[model samples]
Target: MSKIIDLIKAKEEGSKPFISIEFFPPRTADGVKNLYARMDRMKESINPLFSDVTWGAGGSTAELTLDIAEQLSTTGHVANMHMTCTNLEKGGDPKAAVRGALETAKKNGINNIVALRGDPAAGQEEWKAADGGFTCALDLVEYMTENFGSEFGISVAGYPEGHPNAISEVEDPSSMSEAEKARSSMEGGKVYTCRDADYKKEMDYLKKKIDAGADFIITQMFFDTKVFGTFVKDCKTWGINCPVVPGLMCINAYAGFVKMTGFCKTRVPAELRAKMDSIKDDPDAVKAFGIEFGIQMCQDLTEIGVEVLHFYTLNLEKTTYGILKGLGYEVKGSAWARVGDQVKTANGVGVVKSIESDGSASIEFEGETPTATFKKEEYSKVF
Candidate 1:
């Protein structure tokens, strides 16, 4: 019943920071059931401001994404469904499938979407938009605004280190700017970064997405907190004045760290890399280091005034819990009913206008209220 953007804006200035979680569809039925259980437990423990379901490469998991999103929205989580441009079919209305997906999400009462230009299909070397179809995320944002109006709160991807396609190999790291050098990644003895020109284009494109009615941005993962801080300042320079949620990809294992950073060309601090290399052989040590490093990075982000810490859970939870607990957050109990929480009470359905120290909540019903105070037992969290 609540849009993700509304919930974000509803946060009082100087309030405690919140969390959001991202999940991908599991390949098996049993895997999905287990993921659902994990999500339910996560909600009860450390309630996230919103939950995200990724659209697989080439929209391969479209149906599953819709199903999971519906479940999350109906079960008291604000579901942010990712939609992409990879659903085009040959010689047909290129946006037919995309339109269908949007319709389904709206019908299911899911009001948030992450519009993206998705990764290419399996076995494809480069991404290509089908002829007569949308070419990029900007197009998708415009399409949604044109079709759905303000019915959905739309978000778009922001790459702190720039998109992988825009990042290119460089022989001379010496010539790169301080900002570029800090974000440079290495692969096969070569250094790579989004050159200044491409980084500007990325920023301009992001600004256009916002202009086209996208409500917020969820950034791609980066290890260095400075990289994210610089990106936020740069957004202001580019006139992108919206919430930019930093994506925190939890480092749970060494191999995943190596593989994903290499694949995305993500920047890793030299000391962080050396520490990981030293501890790579010890699984428990690697996980322990991940939590330790995550806490430090999160502390830096909080100092920079970020409102939300968005975790790419990768369908796992332990490391995330460890990091939150390290930060002195409660990781094992139900959160108090918050200002933006939607609830159904004996009086009627409404958002919580406020909450008392004793767990009493004031409910604000549509077209009705001198907001009424209700005890914890009189109302339950609603979709």
Candidate 2:
């Protein structure tokens, strides 16, 4: 097991940038199972440097998140589990659940964590700190370093466009400073941006997270590369010297694009938004545009000295794969068959029962036919 920061530092400067992917836990058993298959397939294909699972609000999916993180670690991917300070007051000890989670992560070989001040729990209109709980990600970072003492590498979030909660509508766009304008977004004829003061506070808080113990930063998604570039420059101006990984959200559908950007209050460049609006009715066109746009955005990031591209996969595969393939990354389609997968053989259809080393597997046929082992070339995975 290795820390994600270590893996990153071990890479020689000016080499190909590393690929990292993020996944969120699905809400159902079947969805979870299919996600496992998809994850394994992506691991085989793109070979991400690290994979992370998002934590649900208020520990709602805490156990499931840990399980998925462990699975990722054991299956040859560096697993970065997200830990949040929300609704963790149990037995009057606010840190009890968090402490237990850290212990579990240590035992499971999850060497990195994304410390966060999480969103509100279900039915809560706003976020509030539990009694004796952390108030922000900076506090969580301090706690981890204090308790674990460098046992785990920590990364905190950076809001290139300011966090959604801090972003507000600009009553007079002309009054805004150039920096504020760069971080601003517009919707329905209203301009929105993090006012200069609030953006300074955001940057100060992010710097505190780094000083407290965070090794790196992963930013919230934004469509405009110039916004991200300016944010990076601002980070240096604020004396934040940590690595800031760009979080790229792969566009897969028109509705999802609108919903996510609206929710995050992300600044969508006018041209990109107009193109998306024009092609909103065509799903294939939307995905194709998504891939094409993602390619250009990634190239822009690379030119600006970003060493890693962290993709928010949204628990889907197509757009992410398409973008990578467009960027000249080797994407090996699923070549390994898993147990219980349907396969086609000369004899007929069968279910894979076991896979052996040296490129062979055993198949169990239907209707009283005998089970048989066949060379890898004799059968092909059908699903």
Candidate 3:
């Protein structure tokens, strides 16, 4: 498998923009079938160098993530499975959960990982480290490095607009009388107030992870491209020269966009929000606006010379295809096409085809029935 770190370094050394796509673990048999179908349709337009499959909250989707990663590897594209320390123990103990995930990835030849401290489970009290589990993402990276050595290329998360948990504190206490001060002094006069930690804390944590063997960085999605630009500049100031790829999400539906942002704690710029609100009730208009907005944002970022753009695909191929086509991409047919039936296109092409249960397709091309199996990398070359 091609190491993600090597790929990022290659991009830094004059390679064209490296593009990738991300997907969440499928929840059911039908979901998995649907995802494979979409991957087939998108194999052409988004020839992702590597794809990432997220580990569900509370370690629910760990197995599914590995399964999907294995499938992607079979397609000859690297797959990165996300590993988190959200429920891991605080002290230095081998987290069975993480260990099992790493073992699965190794067995499946899925050598890429994105280490993180995943969000708490729905309605959970707070983020509590599991007994005998690691406490943070850095600890997970350290463990992976020590266990896997150079076998795995690791990626970590970066937040551009700042993490939601981050907050600034102000100290403003009125003067107290001598008697009251004397009493307070007896009870430990130091006042502790909650305040926002400096941005440097997050950066320092990221750097520590890198020092511990993180290969690349994928940032949280942001609507404002300027926020991403400033984030890149700050990374330079902090001496983090590793590839810091920006994550993009195309919000085609108003409700879906709102739900995703709410869950991710990401902001939608006021102007973009206004634009969506203007056509909130009109599905067609909202989709058109979303595609146009995403295309323009991508064009702007491309002009500025970003090393890579990663899309968070929520398993909706039509919308993803529309956004990519808007940004000038050529998509291949679904996973149904046979090997010999694959065709190349110069400009943007989007195809939606049917797939049978046996993972094969028979179609009439110029009065001949040709069969083809789905291949994902063929689409990347056209792009």
Candidate 4:
């Protein structure tokens, strides 16, 4: 088993944040091929220490998720397999599905797992425990820890703003007064409904998960660094000491921004929303703004002692690379140029290399050279 805990601890001790990237299952063969090709391009620039592969709805892409995890593991990066209780059997029923998934991941050499209580399926009003499946994320974590031993580094989700399912109380009296009048002049009482998680409650939950054997906590994506800072403070105050890596998604297009925030229930700052809204009709301008905003956000986060910046690379290169460049980071091997080989440019010169169908590339630059092989898919941001 890989020493994910040690690596995390080392990062904590050194005061340097580690970086991880995430990718979802591809819907088509072409998409898969393109993602692999892009991964090759990004490898050198992003230099991610780990990568996460997400399971699809209802665990539809379980097998594919394992395959991708295994492939990423081969690149010398830790691959975290995502597992959800949405499809697992619970309540003393046969643990066939969960067992099989874990065994498959083990067979493929994936030692880390991120367990989630995934969103309900389409057309479903609410998520119900699967017949014989575990009831919640904590149950899944307990199972993995017991079954996989100490080799598995388990991760759970944290919501800085609060979980959408959590509820808060507010005063309303129009209907209350009539009900009170009929009930012998009873006093009014507030009702609780499903709402976002309260900040303090969220901190308590994180502490519980840590005590339950979660090695790390990866947060739902957010736009504001202040929110993350507050979350860190609350974690300390609540005595939850596990590593919390902030999730970041580089918004490259207005449509993508809308879709992602909607899916994650993340707040998009009004200033950013306005900027995106203004360029909704212009794809080029939107792309430029996305890169700039993402770069600035990254720089600010790093400056404020964020230990790691986890990027959701929706399998695109141009925007990701543009953000890296804007942040003054260069692609790994672009410094040395070779004779007769020229780097191409959409806006500026890039040490050029041809990408393959499988999404791998060997980049060779002109002039003086360094001893490194550049791949396109490895970078979240490349200069």
Task: Please list the residue runs of candidate 1 whose C-alpha ends up more than 4 Å from where it truly belongs after superposition.
Answer: 88-91, 333-383
- State which candidate has the highest TM-score: 2
Residue-wise C-alpha lDDT for candidate 4, range 23-113, written one tens digit per residue = 8889998887766655554565566777888987766687778778887777666788888887743334435788888888888788899
Model 1 Cα lDDT, one tens digit per residue, 199-274:
9999998999999999999999999889999999999999999999999999999999999999888998889999
Ranking by TM-score: 2, 1, 4, 3
- Give the lDDT ranking, best first: 2, 1, 3, 4
Which ten residues in a row are the worst by lDDT in model 3?
Answer: 179-188
Error of 1 at 365 (Å): 50
Candidate 2 TM-score versus the reference: 0.87
Q: Candidate 1 or 2, higher TM-score?
A: 2
TM-score each candidate.
0.86, 0.87, 0.78, 0.78
C-alpha lDDT values of all predictions: 0.87, 0.88, 0.68, 0.67
